[model samples]
Target: MPSPAFTDIQLPAPVLKGRGAIGASDNRYELLSRVALDDGWSQEEQPPPRTEVSFDTSKSIIVQQTALDLPFRQSLNIYRGCEHGCAYCFARPTHAYWGLAPGLDFETKLIAKPDAPRLLTEALRKKSYKVAPLAIGTNTDPYQPIERSLGLMRQVLEVLRDFQHPVGITTKAALITRDLDILAPMAAQNLVRVAISVTTLDRDLARLLEPRAPTPARRIEAIRQLSDAGVPVAVFASPMIPGLNDHELEAILEAAAQAGARTASAILIRLPMEVAPLMEAWLREHRPQRAERVLSLIRQCREGQLYKAKPGERFRGTGPVADMIGQRLRLARTRYGLAAPAWELDCTRFAPPPTLGDQFTLFS
Candidate 1:
């Protein structure tokens, strides 16, 4: 009898550190796959354990902006990387600049902007500063799970309220509902609006795709609560994947409408740089069976490429599948009475608080 052949055992992927980890200023980002060596066989491997959280404070709190196409001319990010860990997140590539993987590391390694409120206040006091609807969560989410304890978002909102600044917030965290006290009064002045990103209503799919986010039902409930509080709330069926969650477009809109969302928006999936491989790995891990089909459909929508970065076509892709999604989204919007009305935040109400110097001048 032939000697029993032993299969090579594979080692798990090693956790990266320093330049290898995300947000590392170093140029080298690395990954090591483990494999077992066996005669006439390859090593077997196991998935690495989940990444852990680490943080650093940013020097400046308010990030200035000159971009024109985006809705907000200026924005703030309370945190870098997000704990919510939505696999299809477009912001993931930003981690590469920090030398981190857009994969697990992007979600696990987070940085908080504790001084955001003060920075915003100072920025607003500048003579060159013009009042516009400042957007929060423009890059990474401001209300990610960590915010509950950090209270950074709450503090930023308090600053916005104090200055009577016009603002817009986009988030998936249901915790935004906790600030109903501030949001409601701001809404009364048309100074604030909220957009909730709802990708799917299927609980299991959402669990696998979003992982750490609030459940789909809870997101809808948050929409309802925001609307009930008279806050102008919208549901964004954003980052719609071609073969994955795209089919739920109409259902998501209808559900959101029922939950009292007056506006609906969508963005085609974006797989910029490292986000492609990360998302592909996610699909293989959590959606292995449908992974191939899903990837193929994405390529079809992206004009045979993994992504299209063209300014006009970036948010909405091209091709037959993209056309279908557009039609479905338009129909849903019309059928559910959702409208793309302007948020039109009030800049007129913006009034800087009295500075000590200003008070002295006034008294003198």
Candidate 2:
């Protein structure tokens, strides 16, 4: 066979509107390396990739959490990828498992588990199943944009309600309010508590940081609505990007508290795997002036790297900068009256739904 000559033809990627990632780089697991370069051709900016959803027929929905550092013992994610294209999303790296680019594909190409409700019911029905607060939205937002049409989250919530199982939900979408009919009753029995993540109060910054997520004001309103409905609402000021929205931490907590958040928590920004380069590119494109400083500070917190997967250090970084951020959060928590004891969901109320065969037992 003759060796074929390859022509060098490089083209620039089109600018996608309403997306956080600057480029759709190849996943880490790819065997081949590919890069794009400007070929001097005039290419107009392209529209954002259309959202696509594929089904995941996993047999189990509940994931047993073995990590002791995490608060929940079990968790469920109704979707594999989130449409809310937050540039700093730690979960973006998970898309690589499907051999997809963790940048754009993580947001544009989604996986939906329509069987989640049934799987959750089956898991809860297991004889060896123990009652514990099951978490939702741990990896991806349960109420992401797709949920509005799929209603899978609502179905899951319905299953939990039927079994009287306790659940802890974390979300950045206001769509959660649509399920107030289900959640309010669960809250009445102390079976549910919700955490609304509000990353930044600045609308413009939030738009750039979390491109498809609900606005900060909308999320705060969701907290208020949930609180007024007698549901315990926690404000999650997560991914506190240093040299960027870190300055808005106090304001975010304050606004959330004022809007009736009973508790507040914060996590320092995490840039693991493919997320590091995506975030770096996003910074250079959106906030060019402060991109270098932001990255430098992130490195300082991560112990001279973009990220460190150590459990304790990953959530809240180390070093003086990390210490200061923690201190500020503590002070703000106390100041905003968010130092209240954590709301514990009732686990004793869990009971498996009666099976079809169990109907005969009603007469007994």
Candidate 3:
């Protein structure tokens, strides 16, 4: 046997329809690099990759967080990669852990946790398990397109409902409205809150940034529906890209408030790891005129770099641009009645679900 020869392959990078990334880039841990190059041969363009779903057999579903700056102490992600395909997703680098590219592969190749409900039930039943607000859609959107057919998120919600556990969900999908049967009741008990992220009000721009997510109008409609159903809804105008969508901040908050968002929040764009390159490529392809200005403004906030990992500065960034963005958000929040504190999901009402054997005790 001979050792295999490893060579980098330069393939074509095309702007596929309904996809956020220009092409798939090799993961950071790969021993070989893959790049796109034109071979000068005339050939028909290949169709874009179709989304593929795979299963994860992990034993646990709940993840404990030690990050003090995060709003939640615990979280669960039902999917590994997001189909929403937002170009600036902060979680893109996580796909590299599975030896997958953080670019197109992150959106096309998806992983589902089929056993999440079962594992969550077991964890919640443990005596050592302390009741806290469990966050869903923290890393990946739990209600991505695949969720419509998989129903994994709905099943997990069932488990949470059975235990009367508190939960917070953040998503850019309107598919969540499909679970109003579960959410409305939970909201009545002060056990659930939903935050919908609307990145841009311009339909065309939103299509480019988050190709697969629901339209901004649909998200506002989702907020209205949730609020009409009595579920407390919050609006997230997140990852505000300076010199680009930042101007829409006030408009977004005002729209959400008109639609019934009780609270609002925002995060400056974060370009960590492979995301920076992907975003730069996307900008060059889509907004070539303003690409340089956008990147320069981002550097202004990140202290002359694409990104800085400082604890307090990561979310809001620094410098005058970031400060002004924050100031504008505060003003919008106050003006639109979105300055209220986040809803306090009731954790004191958590009750352990009765086991099969315990059900038999009723007859005894």
Give the number of the best model, judged by TM-score.
Answer: 3
Alpha-carbon error at 14 in model 1, in Å?
A: 9.9
Write down the TM-score of every candidate. Answer: 0.86, 0.95, 0.95
lDDT of 2 at 37: 58
Query: For residues 136-254, what per-residue lDDT tens digits would candidate 1 score against the true structure?
Result: 87788888888888898999898899889989999998999999999999999999999999999999888777877888999999999999999999998988998889989999999
- Model 3 CA lDDT for position 355: 75
- Steric clash pairs (candidate 3): none
What lDDT does each candidate get?
0.80, 0.90, 0.94
- The TM-score of candidate 2 is 0.95
Which candidate leads the pack in lDDT? 3
Q: Candidate 2 lDDT, tens digit per residue, 25-107?
A: 78899999677655555768656579999999898888888886799888999999899999899999999999889988999
User: How do the candidates rank by TM-score, highest first?
Assistant: 3, 2, 1
Q: Give residue 167's error in model 3 in angstroms.
A: 0.2
State the weakest 10-residue window (summed lDDT) of model 1.
18-27
Runs off by more than 4 Å, candidate 1: 1-57, 66-68, 356-364
